[model samples]
Target: MTVNDGTATGTTHGSMADAELVSTEVLLAKPKRVVREDLKMPDGRVIDWYFMDTPDSVMVVPLTNDGRLVFVRQYRHNLKKHCIELPAGAVSAGEDPAEAALRELEEETGYRLAEGEELVSLGRFYSLPSETNKYTNFYFARVTWDHEPILDNEIEAYFDMSVVTIPAADVFSRLAGEINGMETAGALMLSQRYIAAA
Candidate 1:
């Protein structure tokens, strides 16, 4: 597909950065949405309404030549439960998704990638359309080490997401319910497309 620089309107074949939609109009405006606070059917009732615009984020599935996929199992105080998600976080001010993924990988997982193998951009994703305007970029990092992964301070204490691998053949099972996060799911979906093409 024909592509535009710094736009994601309809581009399908260019570098993702070229297609990464950064339209100020789309990014700047508050979400144009409404929530109804009161509902009257056969009986009159009231509830609540809220409007929100979610943040831009990133998700990663760090891989090593030895065939390990970095997975983080953390306690989500908000959800009040633990989920096995890949390392991830929101993109910071003026930060690129790929760069954020790399930094988050090191900060959360402490596994360094070899100098050359960097992120292969998967694509952009939207989360929770009902209330969020967030976009998450998926990334893959290749590690060169042959040992167990080390963990960062807060991550080590709050969550037990030590890097581990699910066999290539068992991905559908391991990552089935919630073994991965939203971005991880997106990345795996893209990777499946890559594998199918091969």
Candidate 2:
């Protein structure tokens, strides 16, 4: 069947035969898209579903040749606090996820893969399957300091981000404490498995 509410339209296919979209209202836009969608069920009942529409991104778990994990400390305006997280960033339009991982590593931590070092893919994950469509691709890389971190102008001015390096062995212990982002923790788990298997 088909449903439209002036601004948005939705159609039900074979798998969604029992559900139909009634309407959709955009709550927030831009970098993070949030919306409220109304749906009609097979029982003639309507319900509201709120979700986020975000672009896929990449997260890097950078390891220095000497076995240090490269992290970044930055202010999170939403939390009104500083957070320690892995080097990560959004994958630019038409850019490869691996390339984005490498770029974020260098941009946020001033670290880049050495001549013989390589970027290893751990895998990809949905940051919040129920709430957002954003998938984060994870990678493990051994890097060396090449230059100072170059943050985006807004990040530099508002977040005051700084690079922090810690022993890879300490990651688990740190994760047991108050880590900020769930995506970062998930990335750590995947990277740990990758390291163990290698």
**Evaluated with lDDT, which candidate comes out highest?**
2
Worst 10 residues of 1 by lDDT: 16-25
Estimate, for each residue in 30-79, the C-alpha lDDT of model 2 and write its tens digit: 65789898888876777788999787899998887677888999999888
After the best TM-score superposition of candidate 1, give how far the Cα of residue 88 lies from its true spot, in angstroms. 0.6
What's the TM-score of each model vs. the native? 0.63, 0.83
**Per-residue lDDT of candidate 1, residues 1-198 (tens digit):** 335666445433433223322222233343233333332322223333343455678887666665556666778777888877777876877988788887777766676676687677777878776675678888766755444545556446666556555654566566657665656666777776533332
Every model: Cα RMSD to truth = 11.3, 7.5
Extract clashing residue pairs from model 1. 73-161
Error of 1 at 66 (Å): 1.2
Candidate-wise lDDT, in order: 0.62, 0.82
Evaluated against the true structure, the overall lDDT of model 1 is 0.62
Model 2: weakest 10-residue lDDT segment is: 8-17
